[model samples]
Target chain A: MGTGFLDAFAQEYKQLLDSELRLLVERLDAPSIIKESMIYSLEAGGKRIRPLLLFATLDAFGIDPKNGLPAAAAIEMIHTYSLIHDDLPSMDNDDLRRGKPTNHKVFGDAVAILAGDALLTYSFEVISTLPNEFASADTKLKLVIEMARAAGTEGMVGGQVADMEGEGKKLSLEELDYIHIHKTGKLLKFCVVAGAIMAEASQSQLDHLSAFAHHLGLAFQIQDDILDLTGNQQVIGKPVGSDTANDKSTYPQLLSLEGARAALSNQINQAKEFLKKTGLNTNLLREITDLVASRDH
Target chain B: MGTGFLDAFAQEYKQLLDSELRLLVERLDAPSIIKESMIYSLEAGGKRIRPLLLFATLDAFGIDPKNGLPAAAAIEMIHTYSLIHDDLPSMDNDDLRRGKPTNHKVFGDAVAILAGDALLTYSFEVISTLPNEFASADTKLKLVIEMARAAGTEGMVGGQVADMEGEGKKLSLEELDYIHIHKTGKLLKFCVVAGAIMAEASQSQLDHLSAFAHHLGLAFQIQDDILDLTGNQQVIGKPVGSDTANDKSTYPQLLSLEGARAALSNQINQAKEFLKKTGLNTNLLREITDLVASRDH
Candidate 1:
């Protein structure tokens, strides 16, 4: 896999998104500390994979990816809120994320929780207030529906609950798959489906892209597990092997390390097959798939 | 202050909202505990004033209050989620709400937090997926925007941060009003505006109704503070004077008790004046406003 167009596309959009997200929060007549905490975690450097996927999906359809800016920012807010809440002392209790103090670590736990809640609530507001020129009310409503479901109980939150319950127990592959599919996969799929919606793609095209995202989601999580075992602490931004330390189940724990690698490869291949079926300019998506499968962090 | 019409209307709509809220949580295919936690708080027996206000607003427009059910449920969910988070150990740390153990007490902090997150997310989904037969996409989109703004940073969450920061400090009347208006007043106002939007009222009507709601929200919060200081613990469902115990400023604290009562009366009058200006069938709203001003809890 070559790091060709994805880097240039990502660089342009990531900068646009970073500023757009900042302005969105900064302009709110809210309390300063909460705004600071929200911007702090949001600016915390992750790969911005979810927003990139959304922009890339639009790019795949030969559309200007900037049209999806509000949706991308909304989705990133949801993702960022989940991370903030997940790192709370009551939850993952992590002190560092992306090599910086977690939201709760810098702000008190109370403010951190409120910051997450504010971000989650703001995501919907961002979409609902999208300008008429960007999308119709119908389109905005659809985006909100998709976003809410992907982040709510039937998706990421549900996955988090199941993962929490499955801790300290030997989990079956099927159970692990259920967790990953709902937790990580649903939102990734939403990113693609949202792009297709914005592009007014046919139902068949949306269906194929959704399938591509599903496989890509699992492959992404599997690589996450693999990276936990083998990636560097400095690169990954948190201590490696914390999943093992917590005695939680992972792809590498259920499947052997080599087996997890093979599964990741299989998922990547399946994701590519669905991308091919979409019959759009999927080169960007195809490259993203390879990156998810092989990312160092 | 006749209770005749308000009692009958309240009983019928309150039951409808309670069951509808339950069904909304029950139907999710997510984990049982999270669902149970969500439902537990939904059933925790508060007045359901937000939903009632919404239903009453529609009734004022001579529209069937039933048409407002989904939006009613959505607002109540936002209200309920805020309560759950407010009772978290990091925040208020209260064990009791409405005479029952708070959500975190029964479900644990982790599940309680997720339950709040899930409810908040689902509220947007509920509005976005409103059946086309009931409302047009334009209406739903507007409803989402109003609901999100009322519940998000500029409204409830912003108010919460201010309230949290003002704890154990001397707060001026202006500062206290700011907290009440944002923290409680915003969602309350959303209920009324949502009803007008759903009924497709004219901009003039919406503006009047919004002003009415603003005053009503302040009256409601002032009465809440009065109750906390003077009402019975059994009747109010929590200990009286928790506000004083926490060193939080209240209407009665900033103004003398007699002065607070006078202020409450002033707001109620202002709220009614706006309602009368709208020239709708505001009998129901007038009655509910009276009820809010005098409620023990």
Candidate 2:
């Protein structure tokens, strides 16, 4: 029912966020080399899913998607910084991300690390200074708190550490869920919560949206696990089955391949139900959920 | 006139901040390893100059020093995070800091990196959520803005990059000043600004305190450069003359050792002049200025 609208909204907002990311980095009164390093990664191609979810959520509330630009860019920066650090030789040691050389590979590790640090710090500054017309001071403060919690230890960082610790060992299904939920899932959930906060959604509406985000986040990660084995190398941009190659636990590892697919479908369906309960025009969000379920990368 | 007062004030608040640092890390619901890594560096024992400045600024304004605890901790977290990242093998490659192993040395590179990221992210969160008794929402938002600007690319990170780019080159006094002002100077300035913000000082008072802070920051760095050649290794907790050994440009390298000492004394006197203009009980601030001018480490 919403395929065309989702496509149009996604295309329009994706371009808007891309330019915003570039402009934001360029606007920093920093050394040119660091700015250039930051921009190189910011301009690296990704699906921009977090920003899409944020824009889609605002769309659901009938708010102007432009209102989400600062936040969308901030979240993307956080995500990109994580990826940069994750690809360091001490971490995952990957040379390529999305078919391009990693930040460390291009800038050398020192500048790359500083660039990542700069992006992470700059994000809070961006969110805290959102224009008065777009958000109240209280709203901005709350957003900062939420973003920090989601991206900090109790959420993404904690999850990443758990995932690292869990490597080279067989993990229970519960353990696998724990790692994905904190590591990848929290930031994705933040995209939704950030939208709801900006929209000033009621308590009940916020709860429904939060539940929808939780399910959607799980579905997104499970789909990623599925695609690791099934996605085309050309489409996914990295080697297929790299997760298996690393002996990492995945949904398809803990649950059989068929079982992982069933879990993904269940999560998607439940996410839709929560969206329905929000009693808002959630067509864009629903379509985004569908896309997450089926995306190759 | 303020000798005993300065000693007592510094002693009392440094202990308060030291405990607060430990408590803050313990309160985080993160993996023990990352928390330990973060705490390891946080406890690695610097003079707590930033927090002390903040507390002293509050004291000047007749504000309760306890009110500045959150902001003080937040600034310390940012400082500690920078050290952890800066000491990485790809960066300074320092194995020892303050006579103890660096975070990367103890925690491994990957965890040390993540721990730094976590501390940096958590700092904004800490400031944004300052309790109602400590700061208003508007004040918290402004603090976040100022902190980010001071710590992010426009400030510390920018300075670090410039410093890195200037390494092994013959830097002019202006170029060296540029690196120190942004890299180290900005964060120190933040401590004073943060204190003024919390104390709700008038614009004129804030301006005077900021000027004082600028001179103090420069004085602090110049003394650091001087001490690099002449400090006792036991008291400084690192080998003396390390900066000269690295061929990193220092005030002594550019201005000569005597010229660097002259610069330090000049900055301290200028800092005291600014403090006098503030028309507050700035004895603590004044004494701190003197300490910076003469400190061997």
User: What's the TM for chain B in candidate 2?
Assistant: 0.97
Compared with the true structure, the alpha-carbon lDDT of candidate 1 equals: 0.91
With candidate 2 superimposed using the best TM-score fit, by how many Å does residue A171's alpha carbon deviate from the native?
0.7
CA lDDT of A193 in candidate 1? Answer: 92
Q: Which ten residues in a row have the lowest lDDT in candidate 2 chain B?
A: B1-10
Cα deviation of B4 in candidate 1 (Å)? Answer: 1.2
Clashing pairs in 1: none
Model 1: number of backbone collisions = 0
Instruction: Report how far off residue A215 is in candidate 2 (Å).
Output: 0.6
True-vs-predicted CA distance for residue B293, candidate 2, Å: 0.9
Instruction: Please give, for residues B1-297, the per-residue lDDT of candidate 1 as tens digits.
Output: 698988998899889888889889899999898999999998986788888888988888888899888888988889999999999999999998877899999999999999999999999999888778768999999888888889888999999999999998999999999999999999999999988998899999999999999999999989989999999998987778988988989999889899999999999999999999998988889998889888887
Encode model 2's per-residue lDDT on B1-297: one tens digit a residue: 446888888888888888988988899987789999988998887788999999999989899988898889999999999999999999999998877889998899999999999999989988988888889999999999999999989999999999999988999999899898999999999999999998888999899999999989999899998888989988887888888788899998888889998898899888998899999998788888878877767
Error of 2 at A263 (Å): 0.6
Give candidate 2 misplaced runs (Cα > 4 Å).
none
